[model samples]
Target: MVRNSRILIVDDVVDNIRVAMNILKEENYEFSFAQNGGEALRLIFEVGESFDLILLDIMMPGLNGFEVCKKLKENPTTQEIPIIFLTAKVDVDSITQGFSMGAVDYITKPFHAAELLSRVATHLELYHSRELLLKHNINLKAKAKHEKNRLLSELEDSQKEMIFILAELMEATSDETGKHIKRVAETSALLAKYHPCLNDEDVDLLYHASPMHDIGKMTIPLEILHKPERYSEDEFSLMKKHTINAYSLLSHSDRKLIKAAAIIAHEHHEKWNGTGYPRGLKGPDIHIYGRIVALADVFDALTHKRHYKEAWKIEDAVAYVLDHRETQFDPELVDIFQEHLDEFITIAISQ
Candidate 1:
């Protein structure tokens, strides 16, 4: 006995509707009644979720049981409420049509109180189980999504820590301090933000990857990096190999940040016009990341004093970059750089 369950009885015969009502009265169930299909639909809609099960009369006047059943099933709000056909027609075709119209079961006229109650109880239990299962599925999906996001965040942090450790190793062996890589990361991110082709995620990737652009410089002799004068032609040739050396160090990693770092390390030296060293990739053939980092590296190099050179004036360094636009940098990137020139200047000056 489901004391809280509600049933709606739709019948043209007043005595039959009263008889069904009386049978359920002893069970402490709630009841609603309608004289025809039209009245049943109106009462159901007006009461809104008032009935858990519907005992529908097939031969009612004005929108008969089949039509009402079809309408109820088509409506999302009432579609899941189970329906049972209470009809005089016992033919196979009528029963089949009733089931097809969304009836859970059919009862011939003069149904026993036991038979009616049994069918109602069975379908209500099934409906309640399905609803519970649906809620459980939704909760499981949310939990799984949250767990997936947590793992991804941890993995990103771990990768970033590893890259920074390697970057600091290179900085320790060179004249430049950590500030050089920090400026490059910030400036590159700003430039990437303004570029239409790079989304927010790409901008973030560039910031982390740009700092490791010179990790290969760790392989160079400290004497060459710390020299008081410009490199000899032979020394310069050897210095260029640090680009290839960097590629060799970081290229093997399958991680996305590391892979991006490898591309920057290998191709940042290559120029847009193909006059640059190493692979000599030209124009669009060179990765956009390499082209982006190239400007950042040179800008930082010119504005900061190294053992081999004094710091250039801000205006002088800006002139050098714009002068080499297509010859050394991506032309469109250079245009974006010019638009955000003041922002880059601020970053370069800070620390």
Candidate 2:
């Protein structure tokens, strides 16, 4: 309905061109004419004159209307320009060929002025509306992608904050330092990266979740948690319940990181030989996340001085891990630990 819509008219006869222009002039459209199909193509292609609709005559000398329509439809730039065959060829074959060639409609030589105006207006409106819809869909998809990324970022931030807060609460009640938690997180992530079954995302999840392995220590009394001497039978029994306490506290969450933390907290103490506590799960029956963090937590704990024990030398810690393999730790995880020993040493020394 916008004023001054541009239209291209191609006809060998000057009268036919003039008639279409005259009939359409009252609609306030700008008109361009070509005597042959070649000129119409030149004006549309070489000259780059944009048009809303094209009124093509079928019987032109060079590059007849059908050929022009075919070429125009093949071109991506001009393909969407609506074309109406304005000619005297009213046979079924000619009409079928025109439609097949991508002409929007066909009009016999003497078109009614009212019909021409109505058809042109209808097709132009349809074309513009389609263009608007395509753009809207593209913008909607882009906005949805942006919103999804923003929400994911916020969720990840919240997970990290929750992990640190709970980990620090455990640290506050026990001898574990922030550095121990950091080293455990880094070592767990490093071990997960080299594990055959785990992917990068799994590595990241373990990295964040490993720090909460002792989150249950927050529930232990300071007398037991910070005891300077080895635990007696009853004291050790009560101490071992920290793992169950951590699982109980964390397993209620539906969040992935928290759920992974729950598994690590509960199973990090389990021995590969079924000598470990809580459920006596052994070997592959243990979750990989639990198996990975168990090794990391012990290695870091042994290298660092605790209230109950002096820090063993790094070499001694490594020997202890190798010695305890298959008894206290998963065999495969111990292999990973030995293979990546240098990296673990670097993380411990740096942190």
Best by TM-score: 1
lDDT of 1: 0.89
Tens digit of per-residue lDDT, candidate 1, span 151-243: 999999888887878888799898888899899999888888999999998899999999899998988888888888878999998899999
What's the C-alpha lDDT at position 57 in model 1?
91
What is candidate 2's lDDT per residue for 1-351, written digit by digit as tens?
756889999999999989899998988989999999999999989998999999999987878999999999999999999999987878899999999999999778687988888998888888888888999999999999999999998998899887988798779787778888889999999999999999999999999999999998888888888788888999999999999999998899998889999999999988899888789998999999988888898999898988878899999999999999989898888999899889989987787
- TM per prediction: 0.83, 0.74
Top candidate (lDDT): 2
> What's the distance in Å from true for residue 46, model 2?
20
Q: List candidate 2 segments past 4 Å from native.
A: 1-109
Candidate 1 TM-score over all chains jointly: 0.83
* lDDT for each candidate structure: 0.89, 0.90
Q: List the residue pairs that clash in candidate 2.
A: none
